[model samples]
Target: MTRVRRGVVAVVVLLSVVLAATPSTVAASSVTDQLIRRLNRQLLYMAVPIAVLVEIILIYTLWRFRGNDEPRPTRENRQLEITWTVATALVLLFVGTASFHALAHPSVSTIDGESSDVPDDAVEVDVTAEQWEYAFEYPDAGVATNETLVLPENRSIYLSITAEDVVHSVHVPELGLKQDAIPGETNLLRTELTGTGEYRLYCAELCGVGHSGMLSTVEVVSEDEYEAWLEDQRAGEADNESATDATNESSGGDEP
Candidate 1:
């Protein structure tokens, strides 16, 4: 077989092996995740074919004129050049369009300035990151927790993320969400929960010695359950405040 024929055969065999190893489908839990996965697959498909074609052309050119003592100057083909130029432009346009579609999504991008675009009914939570831990506060509910981030399923969420110390990042792979927490600056991350489940949260940036231990859980619960939990927390906070006030009064009376 000629060298060009061997190269063609090799390319075919390699493609077959890769196709067989690739999974038919990958499951995604959220719409944003699905969009990202689709974009990745599209890029992969385009890249593989382009790489293979380039390699085949390189191999053929190398082997076809191996023993030529005097090589003639190559003639330019305007038609081929124009065809490839147009093709390249179209490919770049497609990539830019697809990327913009994904990036414009509220769940994928951060909000700037006033959050007028944010839904009025969206749950608002302030996320504070320190050296070794994260704190979640629900301003509307007047509840705060450092253990877990509790969110309501099937509802839009707006998280105002900031850092108390060094820079940190909140990453939730399952939700396809990541936002940086910078000191004195708050970034808004918006997303809608689709189901009730526990997702792992991690600090993607290395902040300090305990960076590895900065882990938490995001718990998505039903609307009713979330309301009940918030009520319980409020009541507990009220009782604590009352007890502290009574103790202070008793100490003052004894002092006089």
Candidate 2:
């Protein structure tokens, strides 16, 4: 092969090697994540070969027609045009179908008036976003936390997200969960935890000056551990309320 051909071969080989070695590093911790990862890999596999073929064809055409000769008008081939058009349409159809399959997954998106596929026992949590912080409240457990979101492993989770101030987004990349938190409007996100671990959470939208610092943690633990944590939070809240009442009574007694 000539020098240019050899260089092209080397580049293609290197790209193939890199693509083969690069594994999906983002761990899928939930059903939503798994679906998203699978769709991404499907698209990548389809796109890479097409891209490589197009590049190879372009390179070959440039090299083969490099001579300074009179250019001949290209004749249109109806058969070739029809074949390519049909092939392109099929590829697009496949892409759209695959995308819809993943995007419409109940765990990935919840549309209005459509009943979600989340399990009946799914743990529901209310997520409230402010200027620079996220607060999580477990209505059933009657516990709330701002520092960390505690969830039970191997269980479905439903998050009702809303903003108290400007627009914000709740994004937990590990679980492939992201939803906008808009003031006066609530958005729902569903996912099932598949493992126990700590995942980073962030506000994906620019809300205010402290937007960059809007961060938190999602800690998925065993069911027993989650129950214990909720109990602890409840006890702490009770103690704080008792102290406030005692202070109020003392102040009232000492009034002139």
Candidate 3:
């Protein structure tokens, strides 16, 4: 029994040390991700010891009271009962209070509408989700693209998401942002990209048969590159508008 207990303790201690020394020590991109990492680390730190303790107690009890020739009535101690009840309540309260910061983080709220909960300097982008694809539209830049979300690094991106057909959820794990896109209702999520790289965007909820294929890319670029891309898009939009106007005039003259 002593050997078994020692082994369990050694294993638990090693695991606890490994968990504490790694993973969460790395830097996260956004505040939301950092908070989530903190919450996870705290939870694991609390849970591992409690789980090992419970297992040890179970093994000890089974070994100590294995053979019973005559079954005896179990006596309930009022003091013990009260002590454990209070202890459990205190533990729960402590955990809940500790988790409040992560649970009630402001970034998770979808307050008023599109512009709500967004910073003044944040760029707004419209996200439209359909069958198994996503369409990203930049009204300010006059650019609309399918399957790619372009943004400037180190800037807050305010995504106003809505579903054109069925319900879908936007999940960008690197940014720790996820929001449901419902038809006829716009949902907003804001997050800042710290590094310039391509992040994967996935539909977290099952929308249809092609739910697995509902994937996209979020490309974070430099401010200069973003500005140049916007300018090119605007120029293309102007040219298309001119062509449409000329076609409309020619068709009108033919009708007359």
Candidate 4:
């Protein structure tokens, strides 16, 4: 019995140490990851102790209390059983309580109420999805093109997304934002970047044959760079508008 208890302790300790070294990388992408880790720890804390206790009891009953030549009357320890059962229930209760706390948490939702999570100083971007292509439209910056989105750090962003013909979902794993773009209904996503870097975005649903091509990049840039780029796009847009107006005037004058 003693040897068995020692072995169980050693195994549990080794398992815990090994597990402490690795946390799921895919899970860390969301804010809820912290909740998941905490819940896991709580459950482990309860399970490890109970499992060791059970192993000790079983080994002790088998080796120390067994009679080789005499028959023994069976006796029940109701109090002991109830005590361990209640303790286990209490531990599970703690885990359940923690999970409830996470579920009750209010994540960044643009569904209703005051959606001021996206800072007022944010640069608005409209993302339109069609077939298998992605088009990013920065109205405030006078930029509309089928390319990656560059954002400024420490700024909140509001994405008003929609689809032209079918339904699609825009998913950014790093930002933990995914929203559906229905053909008739528009969806909004609000997010902020704390660190400056690049991230990948993908379409969550399989829409059509080229659904795999529904991918994009998000580049986080400095505030100064974002403002300068916005200026360049505005200048270029003005030039295009002037050429279009000149062509329209020439065509109208020659029509009749």
- Tell me each candidate's TM-score: 0.83, 0.88, 0.78, 0.66
Off by over 4 Å in 3: 1-27, 67-75, 115-117, 242-256
Q: For candidate 2, lDDT tens digit of each residue in 141-173?
A: 888889899999888788888899899999998
Best by lDDT: 2
Positional deviation of 30 in candidate 2, in angstroms? 1.9
In model 4, what lDDT does residue 92 have? 75
lDDT of 1: 0.85
lDDT of 4 by residue, 1-256 (tens): 9777866876786567557644444444334334445556666666666666676678567666556578677789999899989987887788789767755544345452224556559778888899888888987666887778878877767778889988898887676667887787667766666666778988898899989988999887789988887788778889999999999999999995
The segments of candidate 1 whose C-alpha lies over 4 angstroms from its true place after superposition are 1-13, 16-24, 59-70, 242-256
Cα TM-score of candidate 3? 0.78
Report RMSD (Å) for each prediction in the order shown: 3.1, 2.7, 3.9, 5.3
**lDDT (0 to 1) per candidate:** 0.85, 0.86, 0.80, 0.73
Highest TM-score: give the candidate number: 2
Runs in model 2 deviating more than 4 A are 1-26, 112-118
lDDT of 3 at 88: 87
CA shift of 69, model 4, Å? 14
